[model samples]
Target: MNGSLRTILAASIAAMAMTGVARAADVPIVPYVEPVPVGGWYLRGYIGMSNQQLGKLDNVLFTPGTVEFLDSGGFDAAPIYGIGVGYEFNEWFRADLTGEYRGKASFTALDRYDFNGDNIWDGSNDYSANKYEWLLMANAYVDLGTWWGITPYVGGGIGASRNTISNFQDINTPNGGVAYAPSASKWNFAWALHAGAGWEVTQNVTVDLGYRYVDLGDGETGDIVGYNGLNTVNNPMIFDSLTSHDVHLGVRYAFQ
Candidate 1:
């Protein structure tokens, strides 16, 4: 019985030694772990051209008892700039707060009229105006990860704009002598919508291109002329509306 037990113990020790050697040979030399990117804060800036227009303003107020005039058509491309702050919620989504400023845009018009068909009453008229707008917005975006070192994203936002308008007109004699005076000033309030895509240049910097549309409320008008140029003019009325289109490019930074 003792000799049989000794033989079994020897066989078990030999089997365990061979299994350890085989396992070591099968083990790989290198080790690896799946990757995960860290997330935190980010910022960006952009500039682009804007296609701006003011809707038709018809029969705008003028001198009392005098015929109303239509505001001339105006359009232009202006520079636009923006900045933003963002919080990355995950690998694919982020929320941001942004602000943009658009440079001054201006337009003008001129008209000639025959007052009572009298040569002495004939006069030439003019209209001139300018506007400046600023917006504050909030938006959410989806990051499509990276492809060929370029990261593309799309998003939208709602915001408000402060607008100013300056309207002026001049009346002159047939001989070019000044007959009526020039009128000009500023007005404000508009709302806006924005959307765009951006390219990530690095983990910390980004470049963006986008577009926005703004709707400025109607215009407010008051009497411009008086009888004998002394008494106040009644029948004051407000006319006109303002709107604009904007294209922009910007850069941003991310903080981990």
Candidate 2:
């Protein structure tokens, strides 16, 4: 090719390359965006404290007017630990299955009896025991919208509770009496209502702080027997309307 023709072609190629560079610099660059997941499975663990209550005590041996309570039965506060597996369907909904162990709580009460319908108390007995529970639940929750990486939620659960009564004693205040009942466990219907807030700690981790009101049905002891093998009763003592209010802290790890 001629030198003049070659030089003209080279200039044209360099001008096209410079124009391409200028256009590239003028075009805007898009910022990187993080994607949100639609749904996921998660594992959770929790620890909590429970304030327990017992409505009353019942015994078949005690007639309506013949028995009176000097002190109503009640339970002390207890600690709780739990683990669960869950599915988060969206930013606003989730469900889980949980199992928990409630630590033992001390129980106390005092009562008097009138064998004859005289309305006068013949004698009194002081009751003492310890109780614990194992609870399993299926729960669903509706999460309110997130604000500053924290989401509040409300939920409910239905399940079963294994309530246990142990170390039950009836101390006769009139005499130095020692009557006792064996440890017993009963399975009962259980339910709970939950309210909480979850704070996002990482991309796949959330920390939860919550409160729960739970109904654990009833708990009971085995048949009553005297410590000296005398004056045994045929009926068990029942703890009616067992319930609790709980405060919990937990963490959930989502599988992405």
Candidate 3:
């Protein structure tokens, strides 16, 4: 009886070991996966085109009833370049500080004056100038989401602009005396609204295409002086509420 019992016990242990091995073989092996990365520092560079605009020119000589604008003042489209360093706080938020040099844009306008408020025009002034700016801003953005390797975003910025006016001329039409204003610079409050999409090119690189609308408060020139050494009081030429619509193509590289 002792020998029979020992054989049955040994057989049962072997059968249990075999069953455990078969169960292990029936289970599938899981492959390892990489986790998505988030939060990193980035460097950016961009080039863009600016379509600029200006509000009406203001001068004491041309009071409300005394000036009739034949052609309102405006600026020609110009090129823009910028660079910035930014931080991605997460997958859906980021901020940056940027500095940019706005290329010189030419300005032109024409206006007729009725000095005595008589609707009859006495003469017209053909205005011309070149304008440029140094813009610095602190910007923040919200990334809506990502799909097909592309991310869309909306952003805003608040900052300052140093606007410079150069080569300003008022050509008094019809044999009238010409006036000139020296180059001058002014600091203005600036703000912007941005919308864009960024395409991922690599694990650490992206290409951004964007549109922006910016307001550069105002710009002005030095006191106007006549060509023949005549200067008048309160003669500065004011460019009210300068603004621009900009399109940008940029690249960003992340440091991981």
Candidate 4:
């Protein structure tokens, strides 16, 4: 080949290489993006303080002309703890299964002097007991729209409870006082009404502060001895109602 022909081929090759480089430089680079989480199922834990009420204490002796009457009854506040699993079915509705433990509460009562039938109502038969409950519930809630990442909610639940009454005693106040009604466990229907707000800490985490009005039906004691030794062992006292107003703080973690 001649020098003219060789030079012309070299020039064409050089132009093609430079054109390829220019095309590469014209392409744009894309920045990488990280993934974000969303909600589905969740797990929760909670703790609370309970202001409990023990309704009237009923004695079998209060029936007919039995000579026993309830003068007064009261209860002390207690604590509670729970755990649950739930599903979020969109941004407005959710459901959960929860198990809870209510700490023991103390009770007190007085049986007045109806035994004398004088209608003066004078003597003191003192009563005391400790109660606790194991509760299981299925609940549903309506989550109002999120505003500033805070969601207000209302809900309800129906369930069962194992209520226990322990360390119960009835002091005669006359026979130098005595103990009656041993420990006993009973199962009952339970229900709750709830209102609360949830604060979104992140896409997958939340904090809840709430209030609940719960009803635990009733509880009772074991056999009663009446005194140190008596046929009163045939009787057991009943706590007519067990109810509470509760304030709780909780945390929820959602699975994305």
Best by TM-score: 3
Clashes of each: 9, 0, 0, 1
Could you give candidate 2's per-residue lDDT for residues 62-155 as a string of tens digits?
7888888988987888999999999999989999999999999999999988998887778899999999999999999999999999999999
Candidates sorted by TM-score, best first: 3, 2, 4, 1
Candidate 4 — which residues are off by over 4 angstroms? Answer: 1-39, 64-71
Error in Å for residue 82 of model 3: 0.2
Q: How many backbone clashes does candidate 4 have?
A: 1
Clash pairs of candidate 4? Answer: 224-233
Q: lDDT per model, in order?
A: 0.61, 0.94, 0.93, 0.86
Best-fitting candidate, scored by lDDT:
2
Q: What is the lDDT of residue 93 in candidate 1?
A: 83
Lowest lDDT 10-residue stretch of candidate 1: 178-187
lDDT of 4 by residue, 1-256 (tens): 9999999999999999999999999999889988654448999999999898877787676645434556567778888999999999878889999999999998888765556665765456888889999999999999988899999999999999999999998787765778676789999999999999999998888999999999999998887884646763367888988889999999999998
Name the runs in model 2 displaced over 4 angstroms: 1-27, 32-34, 231-233
Assess the local accuracy of residue 159 in candidate 2 as a C-alpha lDDT between 0 and 100: 100
Q: Which stretches of candidate 3 lie over 4 Å from their true place?
A: 1-6
TM-score of 2: 0.88
lDDT of 1 by residue, 73-122 (tens): 57456677777788888877888887777776666655555556454435
What's the true lDDT of residue 254 in model 1? 78
